[model samples]
Target: MLKFIKGNLESIDGVAVYPIISLLIFFIFFAALFWWVFTAKKDHIKEVSNIPLELSENETNDKNDLPL
Candidate 1:
């Protein structure tokens, strides 16, 4: 399977550019994610981190009732 793909790509002109572009896209995505993590407000991060806890608390409290 690997050889088949390599053979097909080798026959295409400028196939190398595809990998470069993909790498650039992947790098940019992670870079943006890292920047967001660093720049996000402390309160926002704390709220997001407690999402699972909040859901569990609500479920426990609402177990005997139905939400509208």
Candidate 2:
């Protein structure tokens, strides 16, 4: 199966460039993500991290307020 796929890919012109482009895109995406994470504000990070806890608390409060 691997040989069959590689054989077909070998026939395509400029196939080498595709791998290079894909690698560059992958690297750039992670690089940008790392940059954003490093530059993000502490307040914003804390708020975002607490989103799940806040949601659960709100749901609990809502349930308590409902007619039993």
Best by lDDT: 2
Assess candidate 2 and give its TM-score to the true structure: 0.80
The lDDT per prediction is: 0.90, 0.94
Q: Candidate 1, after superposition: displacement of residue 51 in Å?
A: 1.6
lDDT of 2 by residue, 1-68 (tens): 99999999999999999999999999999999999999999999999999877757778899999996
- For candidate 2, the 10 contiguous residues with the lowest summed lDDT are 51-60
Please give, for residues 1-68, the per-residue lDDT of candidate 1 as tens digits: 99999999899999999889999999999999999989999999899899876657667778858766
Candidate 2 runs further than 4 Å off = 55-61, 66-68
TM-score of each: 0.72, 0.80
Give the 10-residue window scoring lowest on summed lDDT in candidate 1. 52-61
Candidate 1 ranges with C-alpha deviation above 4 Å: 55-68
Name the lDDT value of residue 22 in candidate 1: 99
